[model samples]
Target: MVKSHRKDSVDAMKNAAEILAVDSEIISRERNKIEQAKYNLNQLNNLLDDSIDDEIDFLEQLENSLKNPGDFKNSLLLEKLEIIGSRQIPNLEGISLIDSMEISYDWKEAVRLNQEYAKAYQIDLKHPFIAMFSSIELVEISKQVVEEFELLELDKLDYAFAASAGLIAGFIDAIFVGSIKSRADATGLQKSVDKAFDKIVELYGKHERIAELTNQQEKAKTDSSKQNIQNSIDKVKAGIVSASKNGKIVEREWTKHDSIKWLEKYKKVGYDAATNLKDGSFHIPGMSPDNHHLLSLAHEPSLFGLLIGIVDQITGKSTFIGNDGMIQRIVTDNVNKELSGNMVTQITQACENWFGHIMSDIAGSSGSKGRGSGLPVPGWAALQKLQFGHINYSERHSDVTIAELSELMFKKGYDVRSFSAQLIPVLVYETLLRCYWFYKQHFYYGKDLKESVPIANNRELARLLLISAGSFSTVDVTHAIIKSVPGSPQFIAEFIMTVNLPGLVDLGFRSFQNIRNEVSHRKHMENIYENDILIEYNRVMSDPSVL
Candidate 1:
């Protein structure tokens, strides 16, 4: 049965290949006939022009003879008249002949034929090997072709709707979801971030060891003295540990002071201006204990951070941007020392420790007074390293780099929680544009709901998004300008707070990509025709008939 089924499959493929070859040959021959007919028509038109000119010349000679009665010849007059009468008039019949010879392959007709052929052979057109042969194309669809055909063209009304939606969204961004100052801000976005942080902290409480620290934190809240509170926080920090699958406890050595004491044998190498420069401990410059979560890449609350933190723990090294705007690596005294178990066991412990440490740092440290330093936004640390653009705030704070400005922003409470708040306005902009696009596609254009979902390789949707984002950015930039006027006393603060860095960066990148795509569109279309359509055509034409 298996052998019979295989043979049948082979036979089906062979029949399909033969059909494709015949079809290809027919198409090629018809195309050649059309080309030859066009050449013949041109030649015929040229001959007709010459014949008309000859008839005109003959008539002129006969008129001259009639004027001179003495020189007039009866035979010459008859010959001129005969020539005029024999000339054929230009007619539509020649055009009709060419039109009749022309070959046109409609996509619907092709599809119908494909279905009939597949049914006859009992072949599933969806089968991977048979799918390519199921459909044929005379012209492959490409971005340039789509544009040239005006398939995704937007009318005046579409432009108006997109712009209006963008304007409305921009206003929403500027009014309701203004600059993020702190996690506890009264904005709706900030409230959402606070809820997320609470959820994370709640999950952290599930761990047995972390739950004990939470209990200690509650007990310390009742104490009035600052000293007692500090001691309780330190005790909690020291008690944090990660347990492996086999129940082996591994202390977070790089972060915890007690574990650092065990690694006093290895020499610490590298400068850390943020901490004590003289101390023989691993440190990253500009990464103070208060702001390390923002400056240290390993302390970020992301998978990237987790991976980097694990590497740092096992290798006993810290990575951060130096004061000179360069990436700096520090070798701590914990290098070449095993914390617990084998290499894999140590890695697992490191991962767990990293997660627990980030959770603890994300909301704030145990000793924080109000809104302590939280983790920086994911990928925010990398952005902070771009130390370009010198701006003078005042005589005292002149020539401050972008990196320094970002640090100051973090100090003023623009942490990961605050970054989440900033996303609300961007979200509003995107949502409004998509909704407007969908409405136009469905109701205005008379398209089905599924087709009008504003998804997939949709050029019109992409164009609309670009325009909307531009409008939104314009309003945002205007707002930033109004809030942070040059020479104002609060210029720096207002500028950093008002300007949506992530949104602006995104818009800039998209604008650049759109421009690039437009410039290369013609080349892209040519490549598609040659590499995809022409190649497939040639393959069908040249491939040996399996039959």
Candidate 2:
């Protein structure tokens, strides 16, 4: 009886061991699957690139048309493309808002300005002069017409002008073309929107495992880390919401209503729903140490002069992140551009030297938080998160000090900004997402071309930092511009958070560049192409600066 009992116990132990083995095998299989999926994605990308090259070869035949400038538009292939374009084009209504808005706004402004003038120059309603004009009913009617136009909304000011002007011209010259409030532009708008996030996620993917974002994540198991990130995101969401109603929509009392009761009717609204990737999950790209390394170097006071000198060399030491009164792409396309050998080597060598010191210094990124009040100093070693972009932590900040630093760095951080500027243009097309896709933050104000860098063959020292999509369209940018001004489109920011009007503005500006390129290349282009693209890019990429 004792022997039989012992056998039963041994069998049970063996069964338990088998179950454990099966579980391990299952996990291994899932990991392999994920790896294969990643590999397949790379393979597809390579295939797609090869296809693009083939298409370029085919396009070479079309370049023949470039020789004939006037006859170029008559090209068979080009006409076919236009036919395709016309088919995809949106309806007239999409453009009606644009034309109407323009006409109405101009009319209102003209009327309003005229009314102000009349009040100063012609109004005598209260006195005998009023009787004089009023007795001449025809003149009074004309004045009444002007007064009516003046009462339109500020935005409608242009609409009124265009309508009136068109009427004067017999409606021949005042038809508006560009459309606002377009659902058709959604795709482009989303792309414009995605650019900011792409940048931020790109930053995180490259630096997710770095010391700055996820030092804690690295220590935990992957599954555990995922949970922690999710929890942190939830906390962040709550914090952002709780911080203020600034980002939310709510009703408050109006000045005319009972001041305390005004809150009942005057409600504010949150921003438009944020767009996400195809997958519902917020994608935190791969982890990297790029920013942890770059910012760490930038904080160095010792190299401040060299940094400035480098930026000056490449970006004219423009004394600021801008040059030529515009901000150009900091990153130069050295491969295509004819950069002299000396300049390229000097810039590259400088970067290597700078990177080396920042990564290896005695105090390095791990230095005491004493100077920064226990928070990771602006530039320090950190476990960077791959999904969310920039490093996030709370600490005391003296505006005066930051301002002083900005002023000092603006003057002396040329090399840093020069090389760093490269990151900004690249950043402009990036998406803002740090952690996973859930919490997005990124720079909203797209920099304008302050100065022109050599289009080809230039050198500069710069650094790349993580950005967030959330930050790109947040309250700090054009929304602030709108709020600061009355009846400005920026005011629409009061309603939309996900959409950055500044970004739209930039898009319009880029269209202008394309127009220039088309003209330079002698490509048969639309007469309105340049202006249209300019407006379109601005409609998407405009920074608050434009306002």
Candidate 3:
């Protein structure tokens, strides 16, 4: 069985008084110092059976009591020590003098303890005295006292090892400046050294209590604040974990076996325009008609409901603006990590630079320069919004054929061609955006275990993807929400008008008018042209660089 260090240490203290009477000069002349030593060793052996808590208790006492100048003086050992002139402590038994002391513990294990100590006592670890302590110093001093008392047979020990004694010895040796160590050691010759050290600590403890130990008043305030921050982070992470665990989002695979069934679903849905697509761009040709274009045209099978379950983690306010406009404005409260205008613009640009040409080229008006103007679509929407809009338009939303998207605005009648071309893609794009906006609401940072779910996968690898995806997704959605507004359509519309589909400027504008019309008419679902929509939607999903 493993021995208990605490029990052994406590037992050693029981016999310390008896060993104090010996004379140092004639070790044999003393009253059986060997016998006294035997008793002390046996006590240590007995103490070993005690529990770890007891050991720690003994250690605390040992640390304090040993410093008392009169601790050993009260016993026979003091008489023995009194007879000898001042001399350097020597090795004892197999243990060196310095090795007997207890300075500090292991760094890995003690870091938390040390941090607590520092916070509670304002103690600085970088101080040299603290650094020298970790185990060697403690052992060293114990060996020294033993050797000085001739308690152990030291002729077998090495001087090199003796030099590595506990930190307390160094403090005892006047190494530390006008600190407690020097004063205690100086007074130790006449007074009880251990008591002096304890008194000094007790006195200091009083002051430390006033500063940190009590923690009465502001704790309520700090606790409330910390709770608020933690709760927010927890709520977000929980949502992500919950979604990943049970997501309605599914990705399907289209293989040879499914093709027989595929023809039943979509045989004529070739790689035509995105107008061939429906709400989810699934190519619902029979139900939606032939006017729409397929924004996402692939032989593959996959559909993800929750784009990434980690977007809500960041700071933002989720608000329902209208029937179709649910938006979140991400903002950071970090005072230390402020992003400069140039930095914000750069990051925003990097996030949405794809829309650079469209933004610069599409904006109907050059906004005022004082408020971040000269940029495209500068109605509070950054290049990120433009890129996001550009990319989103290309991907799941992009179902309209270029030709159909071309005819969307100028066409006088919402005919069969317009219905097939415009309504389908618009439905697809709008649905995806609405779904994405809804999904981003549940992200959390895993702050509170009770509120936020912990990251359960491979931490380093998986977290990176999650973080990137979350950030980019938020950036993209923010843009879509901002630019989708009618006033801002000219913001990017006029720019796009110069390039490919100038009519989209009108269509983008018309989408807003349609929204109002639907609201006034209380339309069950707002009507739209699918074919004309996917051009912008598919561009986003296909471009790896966009999102």
Per-model TM against the reference: 0.54, 0.17, 0.15
Give one digit per residue, the lDDT tens place, for model 3 in 1-547: 2247535433333222112111111233233556666666765655454444454554555555578855643444444343333333333333212111122445334444434544454433443332334357558866774544323232312222222221222222222111111111323211232233223333332332233323443464677775654553343223211122255744333221222221212222222122222344432222122111111111111111011101111121111111112222222221212223564563443222212111221111122121111111111111112222221222333544333332222121122122222222223333333233223323422234332222212222122223222332333334334434535424323222212111233234444554554464333221221242234445643677742
**lDDT (0 to 1) per candidate:** 0.63, 0.31, 0.29
Q: Score residue 536 of candidate 1 by CA lDDT.
A: 68
Model 3, residue 168: distance off in Å is 57
**TM-score ranking of the models:** 1, 2, 3
Give a tens-digit lDDT track for model 1, residues 53-148. Answer: 877887787788879879877788688678767766444223223121222265345445655654654545444333333244423434455655
Summing lDDT over every window of 10 consecutive residues in candidate 2, give the lowest-scoring window: 457-466
**Which number leads on lDDT?**
1
For model 3, the local distance difference test gives 0.29
Across residues 1-547, which tens digit of lDDT does each residue of candidate 2 receive? Answer: 9678546544433333333333343344456666766766776677667666655644664675667656655466666555444542222211111111111234346444433433543432233222332236647666664454322122343233323322322111111111112212223223233233333322332232222224565567789776876564444333221233778755432211121111111211010001112232322221112111222223243455247434433442122111112222222212212123687775664454333322222111122221111111232112121122221111222222322222222222112212222223223333221111112111222323332221211111000011122223232243334443545433322222222333334334444554554454344233234555345544643455421
Off by over 4 Å in 2: 1-352, 358-478, 482-509, 518-547
lDDT of 1 at 494: 78
Question: Roughly what TM-score does model 3 have, to 2 decimal places?
Answer: 0.15
**Ten-residue segment with the worst summed lDDT in candidate 1?**
263-272
